[model samples]
Target: MFSHIQKIHFVGIGGIGMSGIAEVLLTLGYKVSGSDAQKTTITRRLRRRGAKVYYGHQRENLKNPHVVVYSSAIAPSNPEIVEARRLDIPLVARAEMLAELMRLKYGIAIAGTHGKTTVTSLIANILTQGGLDPTFVVGGKVKSLRTNARLGKGDFLVAEADESDRSFMHLSPTIAVVTNIDPEHMEHYRDYDELKNIFKEFCLKIPFYGVAVLCVDHPAVAAIAASFPKRFLTYGIHTKADFMAHKIKLYPFKSSFELKINGKSAGQWRINLMGSHHIQNALAAIAVGNELGIPLSSIKKGLSQFKGIGRRLEPLYKNEHQKIYVIDDYGHHPVEIRETLNAIRQTWPQARLIVIFQPHRYTRTKALFSDFTKIFDGTNELFITQIYAAGEPPIHGVSAKKLADNIHSNSFNVHYRENLNDVVHDVRGLVKKNTIVVTFGAGDVNKVGKQLSKMMKEMPLQ
Candidate 1:
């Protein structure tokens, strides 16, 4: 489909996934122009790389692009889309363009509700170490890549196939990594079964020669395995699978595990990242390595060198004298929140856990408020920030304050802060000597963590 495309324009150019594709196209010598609702670091980086970027969507910005690609977030009434239709320029959803790009190479898509960013980063790291020079586009930043996307000459194209907006079904992947699927994005999907059907369709999109690597630990994931035409490769910590982690060891700052596959002992791989979820991510990467016939030692080496994906258990600072640590994560979903809190609990059981959570969207907050409340059971203290409206207008009865009130825990003292500065002050006052502050959310909540880290670093030792 992209064969006819020379000059391309992106409607949501600042999005991490969209920027990745735009960068790849630019590296391939295509003229790329795009307009975002606002400027971001990603957009600025694209500009540095010679892509024409406009600040806002306007009909005038759609001039002379052969093909126009847009994220699902772009409304149909967007000025660029309206202009594209009026000018008769070929239009495609971001997923369609992604699928077209995948068809030109050996595409490996990592799909899941949670863990897609980390898994893609792990596989990309392993591929990089194995001399594959693979190109990749993850939804989050990778510490290894120093960017969200990379342009490489190797035939491997690794991307996080997002299930949101039903975009995962568009790609025809050679190897698909299904991390785990849970009911999410209730706004788009009618029900749980509806979401499962979408995932089943995504699996069916894989060609006959393709392999689907599934997490058997999740019944939902395992149930969709049979939907694929090709035989599926399974991995997990529980139940017998093709790739499994055993003898797991998790420390305050890192984790180690022994990987086994096909009844043969693969070397033990250690990761510098935190969380048991990361160990599972490494298992998925090992499965990919085994599939591609990469040496176990190379896989282990790559995994050991892996730091982490940004905003996913990303450590920001540590002050020994103050006895405090700050971490940030993009875990807006309930399941992600649960896993992250649990991981931190295991890693730092002695430290007082203080979570600063910013609800991402009104729909998600409404749909999973109960689950969100229950997640705090594992944390000692919680601070709720105002909802990060990611273009979603606030619902009548739903807000972060309501969520804070509903969540019940013995040690959980929840407070609401509407402004970032107030939230920072509240957190600083709440944090004690032995505190591990974790900022959780998919939106600007990251800034909370960043600001806290800066404050901690600048504060005089006492």
Candidate 2:
């Protein structure tokens, strides 16, 4: 259906999802041009790959394009958007184009509020290692793939089905993996049920012969499995699932577990990734791999070889003490933060848990501030950074300091770092050896972890 398009313009092209799509289009020999608020590594990479990228949104950016694809962050008032409408060019949202592309391939959409990136990367790793060489697009960089987007000649296409703005509804995949559903995206979704129904719609889009991989750990996702007409495979830590991970052992830098499919012996598996959430993520991949008829041995090989995706409990380094562990994760949501913090606790129960959290998007912060207040229950020490405003204008009442104060009052040791530099200084001074320092966010907070790693490397041994 996209054959007629010679040129495509994207607004908000710097976004991970948008950049992944642009990479695929560039591989297909299309002239790609786009605009973003600022230059980022993703946009720089796109430009190096021969894409025409503009620094800021402009009406002229929409000129000479057969189609204009914009992200949910871009509104109707955006200059390019106005131009697209005035010029009468075909306009499509990012998700719509992504869905159209998936329809042409054997789509496998990995979706959930918490583990979408990890699960998507897991499946991509399995497919690539199995020699399927499927075209895969993930939100974060997977060390297994070496990149977020890869164009393969194989028929299979793997993507992360996003539920924000109800975007997951657009994808119809042969295999759909719903990791877990939690109350997120309160902006578009009225409540939990509204979000659940959106996922239900996404599941119904699968063909009768297709399979739905449901995470039995979450009742919301498990409940939606019944809505699908075709066979559904349930996977989780619990034995009740069709695919279950039992006797899971989570080490500081690695995890090992046994997999069982429908109460039958599958095999013992090991991955370099840490945490039980990752163990569950592996199960999701195994479910899809089995459905695609990949051998158990191949799946095992793939899972074993997978180092992990970047920014998902990705360990930077550790000193001889083995006491200091520096990790980064793209966990902007409260649910994700809770899980990551718990995972850290599991690996380092005796170590002091130090978390540097950067809240992304003003809307998300405003909508879920109360939820954020409760996320640090298990964390020993919390450092809140300045809000990472993706695009939304600051809501009048929301601020990082306010969230920090709430956490402090709610029985947690919390403090707000209004400035990143100040936060870095304080963290470096206060963080002692044997502290499990986790930097969590979807924004520039990742740089804090990197800076800490550099400083730690430069510091002399005590």
Candidate 3:
């Protein structure tokens, strides 16, 4: 705790990562203030926590702060950032602030192209169950905890390392985890090699006394373990690893697995989540908790109690009366979409699946277009919405319509709608009994899920 740093401002505070950090600072008795263009639940919660919240950015919003924190998504020209610089206030990248927090505690940072949020939340939940009272800043709302962050008294500090801009390198955690590496966030890196090398460097940042947990299931991630620079543990079902999970059983909203430590029986674990991927996330949590000397019983209990993170295959509405289910997820990347859909298929194999996918960033869409096109094979229907800019100027030839057109999945009906509301309207007619509709993206696409669920639920129960 920096006694001298009382007042801190965040430029893009509504972001999941930035909001969690701001909440932690607030709980630490700091005067927190921030601004974002959208008035969201996150901003409102910050205001309720006594942080000064501004709906829009302006120079006036930067009123005399000791330091300023900005997320990777914030533009350099943001008025609050510009004003803070002009006023000679310290400007800290969100990751830099996270690193500072990690420095003060027994850091357990989860980094990777995918499942960072889930893995971070998993470790935090497990440690909490172990009575460690860890401070954690998750990138999404933890459904069981009801908040993305907390300032606990324990030494362990759990958090997600944002690798979008190679910013995760700022963190040197006591324990590090990389869930998996994919070709993502290419807009910020020079090339794929740089991305992989950066992850390698992140694992190397582990202190000699620290542990780095990685999933060797991903070939790229497995390649990083060769001659790795630190004490590291590998977890997966496919490849031979230090930690492995087998006897996997995935239900609609739950999964069970048996763990083995270097071919020795550990214990059976259950997660209140779907997919073998989630089981893999739980493996990382198990590895870290065991390294920290937490009891295997405690680790098993935590994994069993993992309710899940917000917007991560979160069920919005399940009308038992009509049998229509709506799920909302922050699945923007191709790998995420593929895994989630596959999980849904295995969970509700007989249910018709309809997906409303809003492409997140133009750069991501352009970079992963071919991958995106091939992921909708089993979908009953696919609705592509206009790209959510996230402040990125539109890149030529990277529209959602183009993706829709290129998605020549004969097995599924694909359509593109430029308007979100129109997509919602169309979805109303698509959902019926035994249908599972998912809103997929890292943007405001959840709005469609919410609206569709509401409209569909209010209809007559025939």
Q: Write the per-residue lDDT of candidate 2 for residues 1-462, one digit (tens) a residue.
A: 647888999998989889999999999898999999899889999999989999988897765899999888888999899988889998998989898889779999988888888888889989988889999889888886688998899999999998888877888898888999888788888888888888877877788888888998888887886565677888899639888888988888799888888888777889888888888899999989988888889999998888888888888768746588789988999888888788788878888777899999888898899999887876777899889987678999899888888885444478788787877778788778678788999988988888888888898337
For each candidate in turn, the TM-score is 0.96, 0.96, 0.97
lDDT tens digits, residues 1-462, model 1?
Answer: 446668999999999889999998899899999999887888899999999999988999986999899998888999899999999998899988888888778999999898998899989999999889999888888887688788888989999898888878889898888899898986789899999878877777777888888988888988876455676899988768888888888887688887788777776667987778878888898889778888878888888888787788888888877778899988999899888888888877888988899999899999888888787876777889899988877899999888888877677688888887888888887777889999998888888888888888898347
Candidate 2: the clashing residue pairs are 323-434
TM-score of 2: 0.96
- What candidate 1 gets wrong by more than 4 Å, as runs, is 1-4, 226-229
lDDT of 3 by residue, 53-160 (tens): 988899999878899999888899988888888899999999999888888898998998889999988888889999999999998888777889999999989998
RMSD of each: 1.6, 1.7, 1.5
The runs of at least 3 residues in candidate 2 whose Cα sits more than 4 Å from the true structure, single-residue gaps closed, are 409-412
lDDT score for residue 90 of model 1: 85
Candidate 3 colliding pairs, count: 0
Q: How many backbone clashes does candidate 1 have?
A: 0
